[model samples]
Target: MAELPDWLRSIPPWAFVLGFVVLPALGFPISLFYLTVGAVFTDPALALAVALACMTANMAISFAVARLLSGPIHGLLHRRGYPLPQLTASTEWRTIVLLRASPLPWLMQSWLLALGGARFLPYMLVGAPVQSLVGAGMVLVGESLFQGNAVWLMMGVTAFLLGQAALTAVRRRLRRRGSAY
Candidate 1:
């Protein structure tokens, strides 16, 4: 793995965390790509840090996408005279929480939420942990692969997928119940 610059190494953990939470929101895919690479090649501690950073970045991007869609996207749809319902109204906290917890694609979830008007803070709060878990799992999978433990690597991937599936099911159940209220 390429060593980070002295400047980056000198950055405090809190600053790294904040940067992770902000840059991705600004649509910088390079940060996510670099973090993924770091997670793949670095030691576990560094890999974990990279994974967390990437996940944080993802959450920020998701929140931004959701917020933007809430306004401009809504305006565009209205201007087109489409029969679509107001997407902004569907972006309730409960919906965002459920989506964050579910197995649906992250980018898709972010786009939908943004178009639906979910608030940034709530989305970030709900998404950060979930994304972190996913990112950490990815790092672990890479480590297992590097160790030439194909069996263990496969197991890790399977477990990750299964956990995501289970979470998605639970989120669906919660959504159904919430909607019934």
Candidate 2:
């Protein structure tokens, strides 16, 4: 096992809680924290449990905030002569997931979906779990790093890459379908 970094070693529990909530909402990179948890803790299960909880909470809050800000943002863009395409209310779950999973910056995903009038249920149900898979892979990466095992590290990295590839494929398919009309 690896020694925990000094900052992470001394971090308080409340800090972890807050980081989980705020970091994702702000689109901050949190893999380090996830890695630290995986490295320092003796139990991989516990690390995963806490990491996922934080990720879920962060996604929930960020999604809600984007939803709340959507109207204002649209209005601002409209006034500035950049009218966004109004998404139909009948948008399907696949559409929502595909849009949310596009190859954009992390924070933009939330805003784009909210602006497109994505339903809260679908974002939570369809998008978040898939999104969290990446984070879970990240946690696994941390675990591997902590353990200093080449095989486990390679496996974790490969899984994360595969997940990324899958997301890219889904986004591309969605784009092609979207343009077919």
Best by TM-score: 2
TM-score for candidate 2, residues paired by index:
0.78
lDDT against the true structure, per candidate, is 0.59, 0.70
List residue ranges in candidate 2 displaced over 4 A.
1-4, 40-42, 89-92, 99-103, 161-165, 168-181
lDDT of 1 by residue, 1-181 (tens): 2343333446665566555555555555433443344333346667577657667666666666567556666678789995344334344665665666555665666766666656667667766665555565666666664555576467557757865885777567777878531
- Writing each residue's lDDT as its tens digit, candidate 2 over 29-49 gives 656666666644547788878
List the candidates' TM-scores in order. 0.60, 0.78
C-alpha lDDT of candidate 2 relative to the true structure: 0.70
TM-score of 1: 0.60
Which pairs of residues collide in model 1?
66-114
Task: Please give the range of 10 consecutive residues that has the lowest summed lDDT in model 1.
Answer: 30-39
* Clashes in predicted model 2: 0
